[model samples]
Target: MELITNPQPLQWPTLLKRPIFDNAEIQQRVMPILQEVAKRGDEAIRHYTQLFDKVTLNAFQVSEEEMAEAQRLVPETLQQAIAQAKRNIELFHTAQYDAEKQIETMPDVICWRKSVGIEKVGLYIPGGTAPLFSTVLMLGVPAQIAGCQEIILCTPADQYGKVNPAILFTAHLVGIQKIYKIGGAQAIAAMAYGTATIPKVHKIFGPGNQYVTAAKQLVSQTGTAIDMPAGPSEVLIIADHTANAKFVAADLLSQAEHGTDSQVILLTTHAPLANAVNAEIARQLETLPRKSIAEKALENSKIIVLPDTETAMAMSNVYAPEHLILAVEDPDALGEKVINAGSVFLGHYTPESAGDYASGTNHTLPTNGYAKAYSGVSLDSFVRKITFQHISKQGLKNIGLTISTMAEAEQLRAHAAAVYVRLEE
Candidate 1:
């Protein structure tokens, strides 16, 4: 990670100015693949899966037998971990299951809102270098809580036309049966367009790479709702002299190992601590299994030594990191001042991975600086709020004039006429 000291207060444009793709590259590279998928369907899926993943499959579905065998093959210790995570996830999200609220807007104008689950939602689980079975709980528990029916899942199978046994095992743990062994742009296309086997859904959720992010953008353009403008993982750590360099380095490397495109940043008040962190990052990264991928991400990471905590916090708010870890003396106080973030990890004992895996918080979050507007997935993401009104005689008498008067001012004569007609009736 490059260390920059005595920096100017940065703006969003300046923060985003770090060289990534411009729209031109995105349009040029991703448009054709999306177009092809839109036209060809499953054949396109087969073609791309073979080309990119180097896997050919006779069929795409993970059979019932395979799911059972996956369960059997998984290590017992990991299964116990998954079970514990599931319980906590269920406990938190289950509370988010709320009943419809009815409010009397006026004496006669009774207004209320009810949430209904978005039927046939699609979930994409990344199954490459890391078998992220924990993501299953983060997604599945909320979908279940929101009472979503027909939750379909897709992930890229390995070269052997198979997925990690743990991934399959986690799926079963959450009561999902329909699993597709597909991934990338093609998988998003199948979920958005509907194939001979893969059913189309109204909304898709999960974090993925640039191609997958591009695919989701295309899906939304074609009239499908997505959870958020999710991209590869990113984190911002606001640390102080009190922070442990070893722990800070470990946290940075954890997110870095996610992918080559993942970003990590450390904004600290102390210069010596930053130097110590840089040294520890080198030592820790040398032993990581995904060191090369982490190295590319580290190249993009920034360690900025700010003169004060206020300046460091300002930089973090501008970035709106998906995961914000406060390695300070009083993280709870620091966290309170935070306006936006997907998830917050406080103090030395709290690591971002705890939230990522078993901490019961949704790991699917806004990326590419989208936390400024978008939110991480929750039970609410799976449901739509529908407003209802009941106009009894008293309600009509009280609210009719207000509605008609507003309508007439806008010159919506027909709207006023409809209310007038209601009055007459």
Candidate 2:
């Protein structure tokens, strides 16, 4: 990791930029896959599955038999672990479920907003070097809690024409039956545009590589709702003299191993702490199984030495990392200063992995500086709040003139006329 001593605020933008493909090139690559799936349906999906995943599949949908086999293949201990994670996820998300309450904004206007689940939603789980079974829990548990009618999942099949047993087992545990062995931009296309077998969904959720992120953005432009412009995983740590170098190094490497493009940044008040953490990272990386990938990511990562805690917090806000860890003595005090971040991990013991897995917070988060405007996926992401209002005669009489006057000022005659008619009646 590169260590910089007090970079100016203006230089931070260039330093904080995520490693990504050129916008034109990413669009160019993803558009054809989306168009082909929209045109040829399941045939296009199968073709890409073979081309990208190197696996031939007669059917894209995982059958009952495959699900049963996956259950048998998954170890009992893992199943129990998944179940425990499910309960925690369920508890956290279910609390977000709210009861509807009608309120009177005006004298006789009764208005209430009710959250209705997105009827058909699709979840894309990346199936590559590591099959993210945890993601199924993160996305699926909330979809179920939100009462989505159809929850379709798309994951790539391995070389042997098999989806990971853990993935299959998690989906089953969450009651997601419509599993499709599709991957990459093609999987996004299959969900966005209804194919022969893969049904079109109202919104798409989950994190993926650049291709998947680009596909989601492209499809969203055409009217399909997406969770967020979430892509590669990332994390930023604000550590002080009290912070543990070993823990900080482990935290940074955890996200670095996610992908070569993944970026990890460290902001510290103590100058020597940067060197200590780097030494620990070097020591830890030698033993990590994904050392090659982590090493590649570290090439883009940085350890920035700031003057103090205030500057560190300010820099963190500008960077807007997907995950922010406050490994400081007064984490709560520092966390209060956080204006932008997808998820936050407080203290040395609270690693970002806690939120990613068993801690119940959704791991499907915005990346590449999107945390400034977007939030990580939650129960609310699965549902739309539809508002209903009933106006009495007195209510119309009270507000009708105001509405008519405003409409007349805007020169919208029809809008004014509608209110006038209601008042007259």
Candidate 3:
């Protein structure tokens, strides 16, 4: 990793000059697929599935037999782990269940708010170099907890036109029945526009590569609500001399292995520690099977040796990393200073993998600086809170004059008359 020392004051815009993709180019690439799916439905979906996935599947949706076979194919130990993770995820999401609250604003004016799950939702699970079985838990559990009526699951299939066994197993474990053998931007298009097999969803959720992210933006712009701008995975670690070099190196590599576009940065107080981490990363990179991918990602990453924790934390906020790790002397103090981060790992013991899997936190998070504004997926992702209001005659009478005067000043005669009519009636 490239190392920088004595970096000047942290200026948000000057911290890191992030590269921006060509939005026009992305839209041009995604528009036709979206239009085709919107027009031809299943026919467009199947063609793209064949062209992109290199498999001739019978149809998009996975059958009961296919799911059963996938379950049988997975190892028992993996199944047990998935089950345990499912419980943790379910417990966390179920606790997020919100109840309706009624309140009186004025004499007879009663107001209330209630949350209702979206009628339909689409989950896009990426089956790339790594099959994201955990994503099924991350997305599927919240969808189930929110009580979405129709849940559609889509994933890119392997060369043999089948999803990862673990993907199928997790889907079933979370109560999602409809699974599709599709992948990439086309699958996103299929779900957004609704093919014969894939249902049109009120909202779409999950993270993916740049292509998939572009497609999500395309569809959402036209009207569909997306969870957030989720792009490639990235991590920022703030470590000091006391931090275990091995642990810091391992955390950086964990995110690096995610994809070629994924970026990982290490910010430290001591210069020697940065060197130690780089050496440790080189050593650890040798045995990993995904070394090629991780190595490519490291090309875009950097290790900055700052002067102090305050400088490191200030720079970290500028990065707005999808995942932030504090491997400092007092990690709790570091956590308190964090203002921009999608998720956090404190101390040497809290590995990113723990939260990615069994740690009871959602793994699908905002990336590419979106951590500045977006939050990781939670129960709120699957449901929408619709505000409700009721006005008793006495209440309207109390508040109507104010409304009438305001509406009259705004020159909205109809609005003023509506209040007057109500008051008179």
Candidate 4:
């Protein structure tokens, strides 16, 4: 990892820039796939599946027999673990359900909001390099809890035209029936515009590579809703002398191993601690199976020595990392100032993996500094809040004059006429 000492505030933006590809080339590559899927439908989906995933499939849907086989293939212990994580996710998301409450804004004008589940939603689980079965739980549990009518899932199949057993197992666990063996930008397109087989969704959810992210952004521009602009994984660790060097190094490598585009950074107050963490990272890299991938990611990462933990925390807000780990002593104190992170892991013992797997929090979070604006997936992501209001005669009497004055001032005659006509009646 590159080392820097007390970088200027002006330099922070350049320092915190995420590893991204040339936007023009990425869009150029992605648009044709989306167009093909839009025009050719399932045939296009199959073509791209063969082209990108190197897998050919006569059928895209995972059958009940396949699901049963997957259930049997997955170890009982892992099944039990998935069940436990499902329960925790269900427990956390269930609490987010909104209760209807009527409020009187005026004398007799009553207003209330109701949460309605999006009729159809899509979930994309990444299957390359690593099969993110955990993502099925993260997105599926909430969709179930939110009572979304239909939850369609798309994941890439292997060369044998079979998905990872664990992914199928988790999908079954969460009661997701429509699982597609399609992946990447084509999958996003299928979900955005319904194909002969894959259903078009009101909103799409999940994390994927830059192509998938760009596809979501493109579809959203044309009025299809998406969860967030979540792309590659990233994590920021703020450590002090009191933080565990070994644990910090391991955490950094954990995210770095996600993909070649993944990023990890360490902000420390002590130079020795930074150096020690670097040394520990070197030692730990030897044991990681994805060391080659992690090594390339580390080329884009850095370890910076700040004047103090406060400065580090401030810098962290500017970066707005998808995952932020405060490994310093009394992380709670520093966390009070944290305003921009997607998810925060506090203290030495808490690892970001907990939330990614079984801890109650949602693993589908904002990335690419989007935490500055967008939010992670939750029960709310699957539902839309529609507000309702009723105005009684007394209510109109109380506010009619103000409404007429405003509408007339704005020269909207029809708007004022509607109110006046009602008052006259």
* Top TM-score model: 4
Instruction: Give the alpha-carbon lDDT of every model.
Output: 0.86, 0.93, 0.87, 0.93
Per-prediction tally of clashes:
3, 0, 1, 0
Model 3 lDDT, full chain set: 0.87
Task: Summarize candidate 3's per-residue lDDT along 216-333 as a digit string, tens digits.
Answer: 9889988888998788888889988789999999999999998888889999998899889999999999989999999998988888888898988999998898899999889998
lDDT at 114, model 1: 86
lDDT of 1 at 319: 81
Comparing 3 and 4 on lDDT, the stronger one: 4
Compared with the true structure, the alpha-carbon lDDT of candidate 4 equals 0.93
Task: Output the worst ten-in-a-row residue range by lDDT, candidate 3.
Answer: 11-20
In candidate 1, the residue pairs with backbone N, CA or C atoms under 3 Å apart (3 or more residues apart, or in different chains) clash, namely 108-394, 108-395, 109-395
Task: For each candidate, give its TM-score against the true structure.
Answer: 0.96, 0.96, 0.96, 0.97
lDDT of 1 by residue, 1-425 (tens): 78888687644346434335664577567777777777888888899999989999889999988998998999999899999999988887778877777788777667888888898899989876677778888888898888799999999999999999988999999999899999887888889989898999999988777888888887798799999877888888999989999999999999999988889999999899988999999999889989999999988888888888888888888788888999999888888889878888999999999988887888899988788899899989999988888888767877889889999999999999988987897
Candidate 2, 175-233: lDDT as tens digits: 99999998999999989989778899999999999999999999999989999988888
- Which candidate, 2 or 4, has the higher TM-score? 4
